[model samples]
Target: MISENKIYFYPIWLRIWHGINAMGILILIVTGINMQFSNPKFGLVNFELAVNLHNISGILVTINYLLFFFGNILTSNKRYYRLKRKGLFKRLQLQVDYYTSGMFKNQQPPFPLSEKRKFNPMQKVSYLTVMYLFVPGLVITGLALLFPETIIENVYSVSGIFLTAILHASLGFLVSIFLIIHLYVASIGKNPLNNFKSIINGYHDIHGH
Candidate 1:
């Protein structure tokens, strides 16, 4: 199958959600850092302000995530996240090879973007794990911290809030790192900025597949 160079990849609703989620994540990371390393002279945000902003951003992100969750279920976009079990390991290896060696040596991607597949093997797995597992875990921990009464005071002896905070911070850190990798990967392709623009324009410039 063949088509034009441009493909409408991100729909308007998806784009809006993506934008809001991105902003919320950025806010969370910044405020999280400020809160973690509280210092009036050097902190990027006031401790009180940071706590308020982090809570608010966390709530917004949670709501946005729910929307994204339902949107995928209600729309055809879920197809892109679906996994094909056959040759999954081999496909992941090839995609990893392409990223580590092939791309720099002018080799085509093992899994090029297409009307049917928005993600490569690695992307699918990473996205699935992050969105489904890490994200929900983060949201649950965040909500627990936001409302401590809902959780028991201790977990098998350790303070519940302490454990919850540690888990929340750990998940937040991993998600932040994922955002960094996501940006770097998005910056690849013929024109680096084209990938970034595609989200805004809703049309990705596909290299012939």
Candidate 2:
């Protein structure tokens, strides 16, 4: 059980950014589904309206991600990947093993969080790729779709808007899959509620448990 004396951890900016980004991604996914299927299942909206909203939300999500990125940099928070210690590979291996096998046996998590290092080995790799690589790639492709003509005129050999649209959708699908896995793992915490509470109330005190 979490001790009452455990302090709150997450800052206000992280909380706000997380909430907004979640909403924006949801909107983008829903609209994307309707646009892709082009069916009455979701009562397809006007094409122009859907595209406009997608563009705006895309911008918002990109900006929110940036806020999260710089927020971490400015703080004393050492990113997961920055954890400098011997047995880095061993720690990562144990983390992967726990996720794949130990978790099913109800084993306790191998890595705990602190002010400097808040993410586990898996989280470090996942978040690093998502933030530094996939997210920026998605944003660039989305902006290309939003303004195809402008992009085509400036860039010589870059694939056209059609390709950009396909790339963006592919990245979106990948991100959606990651979200499903993330949410499920989150539910596996001490009380299930503990994961949710930590994000909202901050600190997660797994003192005795």
Candidate 3:
């Protein structure tokens, strides 16, 4: 006795890439933590093991990112991340209001899912920033750190490798924060696990789409 609509958004390739990218990012986070904080108090993996796992995860993430980059370029999925400049702020504000206040009051969502609109304004901005800006930054900085010899010897009076390591770690922290927020937001759909199931099955349970 259910009549909810469904839409197929996640293609097989995208789903595969997502699975690998997620696993790689998680492994990188754990291994990065071990390397960054080697204290026996909270650290689980040893430094050497952490370094190895971190490097491997970084490589996997980099490769997966390239797949995502080209996949967007070669597929129709890129439209979801495109920002429509017209009414951008208004749309963003409306979605923000829904998240912050409206949803709490049991109000309907301002921007519901549709065939043409895969994401709201806020999601488009965050996804674009994360996938394009932050992921690339992380990949480049990670590679520089992985091969210290490729790094510049000095910048001003400070070590270039030191700067790269700091930037890389900062990017990792930002990505970690984004991941946490992403997980929490994913649960805000039809049910706690609705979006999670969609990501796995390639079809989102929508309504009136």
Candidate 4:
């Protein structure tokens, strides 16, 4: 068993960013799927509507992402996502074990949430890769598609439009998968709604750490 303590885990700006980012990504995913698999006919919106919405949402998400980037830097909150080389793999293994095995037995996490280290080793690696690498690639590719005339010549050395589309779609697919996994894992907190509630109020109930 673990004791519980309430901590201000998220700040107001972070909460706002999280909410906007989630909504934007969800919209993008829906429209992206619709555009990719138009024959399925399960999309909520038509192809033309989906394309327009996707473009608008993509632009808004880019702005939101930029805000998140600068906010993290200005507030120094980026530290939470940093990965240290020393003992990282070992820590990642422990985290994986906890999630895959120990969690089923109600074991406490090896690295509990704290003010200094908000993310575990596994989370640090995953979030950092997605946020910095994957997201930037997605944005770059999306921008290239949006302004093809400017980039077509520059990228002509490679497959150009075809390669850009493939890269964008691939990154978007990965991000969609990540979002699903993230939601499921968020529910794995002390209470099913604990993690969700934390984002709304900025207070997370810390248990066992």
Compose the digit string of candidate 4's lDDT tens values, residues 11-42.
Answer: 89789888988999999999999898886547
Better of 2 and 4 by lDDT: 4
What's each prediction's TM-score?
0.94, 0.83, 0.93, 0.91
lDDT per residue (tens digit) for residues 125-187 in model 1: 999999999899999999999999987798899998999999999999999999999998888
Ranking by TM-score: 1, 3, 4, 2
User: What is the C-alpha lDDT profile of model 3 across 49-103, one tens digit per residue?
Assistant: 8899999989999998988899789988787778879999999999999999998
**Candidate 4: Cα lDDT at 109:** 91
Q: Mind giving the per-residue lDDT tens digits that candidate 2 earns over 148-207?
A: 775553336666665677788899888888788878777766677677777787776553
Question: Which candidate number would show the highest TM-score if scored against the true structure?
Answer: 1
lDDT of each: 0.89, 0.74, 0.86, 0.86
Better of 3 and 4 by TM-score: 3
Better of 2 and 4 by TM-score: 4
- Best model number under lDDT: 1
Candidate ranking under lDDT, highest first, comes to 1, 3, 4, 2
For model 3, the superposed segments whose C-alpha errors exceed 4 Å read: 1-4, 40-42, 207-209
* Clashing residue pairs found in predicted model 4: none
